[model samples]
Target: MKPITMLALACLALSGCKNEEPAASVPSVELRGRLEVDQEKTSARQAQGIEGEYFRRVLTVDGSDMTLDAFINHYCPADTRDETCQKALRIKKIDDVSGATRFLPQGL
Candidate 1:
């Protein structure tokens, strides 16, 4: 066989034997942040028909499936026309079922 081909074969063999260990599985926990829109900017943002600076708080959680981004998108839609409903929403909890627990003004 050609030198280059032999060299390639040798490298491939070495790589195969390097590491066959299974990847370590780390237990993941759910992290939920309660949304808090800035009161000062609320009026201005509402007038402009846009969202203002908001924050989130970690509510009840028991899993590791839901993420901050996913929770927001699933529960809160940017273009949601229901201003009244939006205003009423306060907190969201990450649950075990959908790995997300959305806690509005009413309840989770």
Candidate 2:
């Protein structure tokens, strides 16, 4: 084989051997904002003495609601394989708050 042909074939083989993986999908901006707003609303309800102890226990710790970013970092940090965290992140509606809270640790 010609030297140039050999070189081209080697490059093609190397390219095929690349171990690149697909990039992780990031949460959409709308979803992020919605989660933050939900947290804020929960906090407000708690302040008004309307929210229940279960919500207070799950969503708030140290007498404060966990910010959306903090919750995501704590529950679903990068490369986390926890089933509860995955389920929590999948929650899409405000009505699902109860379900999501179930994924969190209680008494904290």
Candidate 3:
């Protein structure tokens, strides 16, 4: 039996199997909250393996509890309302929320 012939037959036998059920999806809920920023992203940590800066926030959406993480190129520890601070975060908001940042409560 030739290798090419055997391979063709194997593929033919496997093609009949089909998934009967649709993929399950998670329900999404509207959430709003404050950010618990971890101020540990010094120059040394980033080089080691830490990914940018990370923040942890607990949000209960529709009765379920969960934690979320956020990263940034720069975070303004100063007043988030400061024009200078918001200007810094502009890059992140435009680029899928992965750049300059300042953690602020929901209302500003």
Candidate 4:
């Protein structure tokens, strides 16, 4: 009886260890946006990574033509008027203009 009880406890613990996070599907399209005047490329990526709380590849944007620093300033300002836009401004490198970039929250 003792062994059975211990086994049950172990099983419960093991089951709890399973990854509970929902599996977020990778984005099929690319993301895009021009940097705001006050932000730079590197700063933008750093901000995005921090905001997302994970290193997501899709978050990285390329061919921005706009620096990360400039975007941060114009879009992600300290006194952002729009909380929705502020939350939406995630970290990412512009990959391709052909499609839209995907943003997935890892819930980290």
Top-TM-score structure, candidate number: 2
Give per-residue lDDT, candidate 3, residue 1: 67
| Candidates ranked by TM-score | 2, 3, 1, 4
Q: Local distance difference test, per candidate?
A: 0.45, 0.49, 0.44, 0.41
Mark the regions of model 1 whose C-alpha exceeds 4 Å error after superposition. Answer: 1-27, 38-44, 49-67, 70-101, 104-108
Listed per candidate, the RMSD to the true structure in angstroms reads 12.7, 10.1, 13.6, 15.9
lDDT digits (tens) for residues 7-50 of candidate 2:
99999999999897654443322222222234665676789887
lDDT of 3: 0.44
lDDT string, candidate 4, 1-108, tens digits = 999999999999999999776633322223233322223444575676733222223223343343333444444546554543343444332322212234345521
For candidate 3, lDDT tens digit of each residue in 1-108?
699999999898877676565532323422233344445543445778766665444445457555332212122443445443454244334333442234534533
Model 1 score (lDDT): 0.45
lDDT of 4 at 53: 21
Tens-digit per-residue lDDT, 5-96, candidate 1: 99999999998896665633222323334444445545665688765443433433344344454444554555555432243242333332
Candidate 4, superposed: residue stretches over 4 Å from native: 1-64, 88-103, 106-108
Give the C-alpha miss distance for residue 85 in model 1, angstroms.
27
